[model samples]
Target: MFDLSQFIFFVIGCLATFALVCLLFPHLFTRQKKFYPKRVITAFESRMFTRLKDAFPHHHILAQVAFSALITHDQIKMRNQFNRKVTDFVVLDREYNVVAIIELDDPSHIGKEQEDAERDAMLIAAGYTVIRYTQIPSIRQLQRDIR
Candidate 1:
């Protein structure tokens, strides 16, 4: 009951239908570009220190930590908290206003007490609770602060 001519037409029609479907929904065959979050790298001495910001406790123990522990959605983390920008590592409140600012400092920061005071003042003026930590804080200290 099968005719060769008819079989050829059916095959062509099926191929055409598939091609039409592909054209209508190109995503079926085309690859979409993947999205990636931007990582900010600074040129200061803390460039090395900043990279450690993303590291976890015992690296093997906690592979992934909560975003609330490190990241904010409103603004990107800035190297300087109070100078040119509004604040660094700013966390917003329920009202969507800045609530907290975290500053990371190197050992040299010990000599800049006046500068630190001024930066803290600026952050406080903008209603942000600023917490400055050493470039190499102990895991215990970081855990306590994060908590």
Candidate 2:
């Protein structure tokens, strides 16, 4: 005896009202994001470092650029390693497969050759090419090896 159509219309009206409120004041329905303050460097640091890297002149000044060049020319990609993983650098192919694991050895790595070799071996076992760059060579050298 009761009207089923009237109940359906009432439910639809409530849903439409909620949707309208969400559309008008979208942030209200959403939970407020809490900010956890902490001292940490961000990707902005990398951009700033990139700018600084331009002004500074050194042997490896062009390392970042060389990485980009390799990607552009040979269809590769380099991503920054945030985790303190064994590998310092990872090179990926167009298919996102790790093609190379590069380590830029500076003074800090002088006495750790054996340890580094072990890491390289691990990467090799995983089917990745390992490249250790002690001295940042010229662009020509980078092109020869990367391509």
Candidate 3:
């Protein structure tokens, strides 16, 4: 028959070794810094965001937010695939449900028509109203469009 005492000692030795390694190399188990400087919003985006905030005082407006934050994906593959797409701005109701997404179209978006369209399609399919603006619209227009 096997020796039970020997098995217990071996298990203890393994546990002690793991603890010693963790203590000696604590950094290996710690998370590394992954954030760096990045603009939250461009000047135009800032101006439009301010207008949106004023127009919809009752709602919350988030700028330069990832699409994943606004919607849930049942499939892990789809979620990971689309997690990198960022929205220009998102308008949320009092309960924090996304009401709409606003994109400020600039010169840079000219060549990205297909990509933008795809993103818009995805957002729309997810039941969010998507609005694109070439220039900042008046508060009244925003109110009318959003409503």
**lDDT, candidates in the order shown:** 0.53, 0.53, 0.90
Native-structure RMSD, model 1: 14.0
Per-residue CA lDDT of model 2 for 1-147, tens digit only, reads 889999999999999999999999988978987789963333433343343234332313222323222322222221232123444444455555554555667787889998787666645654557777766555555445644
Candidate with more favorable, higher TM-score: 2 or 3: 3
Task: Give residue 5's error in model 2 in angstroms.
Answer: 87
TM-score of 2: 0.42
Query: TM-score for model 3?
Result: 0.71
Worst lDDT 10-window in candidate 3 = 26-35
Candidate 3's error at 54, in angstroms? 1.4
Report the Cα lDDT for residue 142, model 1: 48
- TM-score order of candidates, top first: 3, 2, 1
Give the lDDT of residue 73 in candidate 2.
22
Task: Using TM-score, give the best candidate's number.
Answer: 3
Clashing pairs in 1: none
